[model samples]
Target: MTTVADAVGWDGALDALAERIAPRFCRPEARRRAGQYLAGLLAPVERKNGWQLAEVAGDANPDGVQDFLARMRWDAEAVRDDLRGYVVEHLGDSQAVLVLDETGFVKKGTRSVGVQRQYSGTAGRIENCQIGVFLGYAGRLGHALIDRALYLPQAWAGDEERRRAAWVPEAVAFATKPKLGLAMLERALDAGVPCAWVAADSVYGADSVLRQALVRRRIGYVLAVTSGQRLFPGTVSDWVEDVPADGWHRLSAGDGSKGPRLYDWAHLPFRGAPEEWGKGLLIRRRLADGDLTFYFNFAPAGTALKELVRVAGTRWTIESGFELAKGEVGLDQYEVRSWTGWHRHITLAMLALAFLTVVRTAAIGGKGPGRLGRRTSALDRAGDPSPAPPAARPSDPKTRHRYCLVALAKTSPAAGAALSLETPHPNR
Candidate 1:
């Protein structure tokens, strides 16, 4: 089972990454602290806040680290662009998916930028928190968060005193969450990040302006839509209500912690469309509770239902990315309250996550340890959904490993070894 991960000289990878992004830091001290900050993020620290991260970075106190985050001269946006380019260069595929989603950062105080008593997905309820809209890149190689925007509610955006206190820029105005996601998508597309489909939850999907923008760009999407979304003449719920039981097809949206996320799916195409471009509605019914979800799909003509389902499943990839970034790289552990500090810390955390993904990809040669019975179902072809028996779950003994190079680098110092630590499935 020894792969490139075992043999490839990965000791210099982080150093090489630091060198690659060195120019982003204007001063030598900033450049040096940047390396330390990234390393601290990668280090096995209990909490990745200023003091703990500083301790991991061998600093006597948190003052330097805090200053680095609060007043660092480096441009977080420029670093974000570098992160986008790096992820694309390593994990890029023309068939890759660009996923948009948001995660909540639970904050106790009102001082944090964009913090409000809003619905926090992280908390699973309405809580005082800041929402960060993120863009994730998912290819056959791997997935990583590449771009991020802090959601600024109108309350914060319009308040001049709070804006001054938080250093919110004058140019930054109130934009909806979907608008933020669209802007990130536009940035990635304009930079030629190379993605085939965009997958997202209904927040973005419900926005006709965003959907129209994607359609105008000729980009495909499998966006979750609310039940009330208009289609042709009748609403989505009305149209899907009449779909015969025989019309439903069983498919896996993607792999989950247990196994394939199997569900019954049905597709209903829009009546009018260009011959080249296909438009449709995709429906998913949970086998356990019969709960339903809907997706508005757009793609080239003759695209298989399997492909659409695959894109639909890709939306979950960003969720996994969020979990990994937050769990592994302090994505949600920042103590910063100001606008600049928030972006800087998040950008660095994202960079750390990207570094891990890239290293893991290189080590494993872009393949999971074992395949979980990848038999193509009989229903994969013919381009429609129907009901079928679920496939038997295979016994996959090996768990997916989270690779950390920092500990290895610490031990080997010269030639970094790979530390393959067992972790729950990324899809969990």
Candidate 2:
């Protein structure tokens, strides 16, 4: 059974997290506004828009919340740095994979920054929306989105008036999603995020510049590509479809909602003496429909197929993380229309999700509190002394929602801790 002490401890953990990032805000009022906004986001609210969030935060005027998002002087990037430090501290692993993907935020008006009729995987069709390129860190500890970039279409990029109205910086220029993904990857590496592999869908993998950047960094990756993408076994003309049926080996990328995601896999090494990092074409054929997919893999020579397949499997974690953030934490429910406001809201939402991830990890006996730089793995927590008893398990969406609300509602001295920062919540 849950106890008051347990609730206090949970609240304390969240408060401690907020304290860690509170200094990022320029003023105490900004910090308080940030804390309240985050609490409202994590709370069980049907709509997490400005008005709804402001009401839940006990503010009579929603314009205050809107102003906080629009005119606040807080450093969103500093909060992001804190987030990266927190994630690396708790979830860092030598074998961790950094996954890249983009999600569409549907918006109706043309005035919303970067909104255009475009293809959204979220909707599975062309829709009017803005895209946010995201980078996720997936390790044995757990997965969470650590970085994000707003995708500005070329039309908006060329339109100085629209850019100025949206508060986009003058130095900001048009960059493709893959370039954005690469920039995030570079930032993660520079921040000392311990990762061995990277994974992404074809949209990124198709970019040779991105693949080359990964090779230069000596980071391994299993990135999907179109069948038409050229492969070089003996010659550059070779394509993924050239692989013979006899070469295909049945394998499972990883577990899916239904069961093992089994497929027929094959690989062919690129021609010429292999560099310190090897190059190859990895293919997957569906077991039932016989549909084929391809990946351009870069790893050390003699790397096993299973390792590449495992890295490929890690790609889905970002998707799962997206679903969880959007559904449970209102990642896509924002009413903000400007670039800075969007970043502020999304960054806060990510901070909240990180807190939840930490809570979930602690509940499962994963790790205890400590400074951000010290290395701690799920396997290394056995020797660490416990700080407080674990909070209740947040395995259920409704249960998780209840925990957030209850922890926020019942104010204890410990609960006085303030600001930290979805995907749709998905069934386990």
Candidate 3:
């Protein structure tokens, strides 16, 4: 079998990424282990646990690989800084959105850090899992996770023994998912990761504090809210369900697999006095079932409905990032049991996914790295040769990456097996 070293050297993109992240580690051995870990992640290993990764890296002792993740002195945040820089360099856009969402990693035991019975969107039910809140940067070129935080339940946070066993920092405290999302947003903004809007699902959107925090930063957002969310149109609070039938308008948020994700949309102007900023309620009524979803939007005055809809649509980009990262880079396939180890593995996996996204974009002839503008449709980037219309490929970026990976494997037999892991077991 072709070795992992040969596979790493076979791809210029992988090599460049390795060099990019090498400086984060002070010790040469640390750097070497980091490279080996990344190579194993990018390798199409069936199970990306420490032992499998160590075996692939040609290490006699798997404990060394575990040590790299568990005890390495490198700063994972510095690597995150590098990741944000790299992503902005390639996919940054003024109109790009910084998206927030959380994914669940199912675990077997209570010993694993932050593991508890929780609602996992990945499993579509309550499961024993650890939750990870992630922020993704999405632009015309593509999207990739820029930062992440592991969510600790209140039980885990209050138990000192459990916390110590997990190596939770002394300063770390119990924080809700939205708070974690806000902290990540602040970090991205502090690093000057350019983005025009912030988007998230109702979990974060329903938090009035999170919304106010965004307003304080002068950052615009289109965040989903529950139907019961109250809004004021003229000093009178009104439930989103109170809107009249005539208030709704047919609009397409963005294109999807079948066609446009058409829905009945309506906007209610806020009652507040005219100011530099604007607040409003944007509602989407499903065409098929009339199931309504509400969004709380904050933007500059005169912002068009299409733009608000566009921002709301961008929420899926983070979901796409999650799916691809888990499927291709083993985002949740770690054996680590501590807080630091989880961050180490996740950050490295994110780096691998970012590299693959960049490669996939370049391979599919995506637009040159440039300024962000109006949203770019996926059809514009797909360099499909078949006579079928671009819509045939669906606007999903993950599909594009899969196709590119398959093509790359065909051209390079040495890296084929390592690049062709089975398709992600359907979401759960």
Candidate 4:
């Protein structure tokens, strides 16, 4: 049946959802105002109360607005569990790959969470920015966002001066980006949602501590290492089969593509501390339109080459999520200046991704070729881990899926609305 929301444009669907989820159940008036404000902007424009922004959210009445939302903390755990069920149930037998990526929001000044002179994906260079760690869901059925976290740079944890300058909350402290990524993965596992493989870029991949941590947890992974990354080089000449080829050979991909062209690796069984054991190695390739590269990993035996490719390919999917959220969906365009406001904007982006994923798979049934999603072409790649006993197989149970854009049913022209026949279509 046609609903009032279907009659409007983009604003309709988001407005309907906001009402249903957080709705001004407690502060209807404030939330109502907040809803209207967000519906108007599509860029990083300032929101004003009067002739400024068409609609403004937050407390109209300082006391009621602040009191209502202030008392509210984002239900991150609840949000994760809900998204997990909705996403996994659609999996069927299809393998779900978790793509880990970090995108930075360029901040003009300090004070934003995790803001530092770091590499900003959005800006494509090093700058002062806020970094968000994310997990993207990919299978034949759909491509969607799964979880997120704001990386609190070490400055926030170690230096009191920077912390004070950046307004780092007394409760907020420094945590590594990988640590945050691990926390997000654990949340999904606790909720009983499992991924077939985890993939990342060199930043997280090259971290020895992080790699060992994943090995201990027994999570299957693939990561890119710098050309200079250290590894035991196995024997070059073939030797006796049962001789226990303990001899090591450490080689380099040496400026292969970005760093080196060839790889130097060893297949030593997982060794070192418990968290660093229970793993082996695999070198997989992603043959996309862009230049394909080899990945160096410490994976167990019996892992499939194709499955590793799929998981590694998943990293490209997160790039799509970031592009759509930032450009088409208004991720960084929010006008709210507070820290809470920044997170709320990102949460909305996540919700939008989840909502779109569910709709495309369940209602629209994603199917087609050469849709909106672009293939990946990253200069570097990475992966993740969990400390545990070695698993019997490389990846878990298998499934198949192919994805495309959601088939949105077109709505007839809105009733009682005027159309400007002479106005040229802006898209033209």
- Output the number of the TM-score-best candidate: 1
Cα lDDT listed for each candidate? 0.79, 0.76, 0.75, 0.49
Q: Which has the better TM-score: candidate 1, or candidate 2?
A: 1
What are the runs in model 1 whose C-alpha is more than 4 Å off?
1-8, 366-428
Give per-candidate clash totals: 5, 14, 1, 37
Candidate 1 lDDT, 1-428, residue by residue in tens? 55554434343567666766666676788889998999999998888999998898888999999888777577778778878877877788999999999999998989998999999887899999999999999999899999999999999988887887787877789999999999999999998899999999999999988989999999999999988877645567776655544446677778999998888776766534455886777889899998889998888876766788889999888999999998999999998888889999999999999988877776577343222112222223223243332212122221022211111001221221222111122222
Better of 1 and 4 by lDDT: 1
| Model 2: per-residue Cα lDDT over 126-243, one tens digit each | 9999999999999998889999999999999988778867777666789999999999999999977999999999999999999988888899999998767654333222454455
What's the TM-score of each model vs. the native? 0.83, 0.83, 0.80, 0.60
lDDT of 4 by residue, 1-428 (tens): 32343334233444544443432223455456444434433324453222333423332343433332223434323334444554565442235666778888777766555677998877888888788888776667766677877777676667665554433455566677777777776676565566555677877776667666666666667776544445444321221121123211222322222653222122322233234223433333222332223354544444433334345556767788787667655566544334444554566556656555544454344332112122111111111121122112112111011111111112221211221112222222
What's the lDDT for candidate 2? 0.76
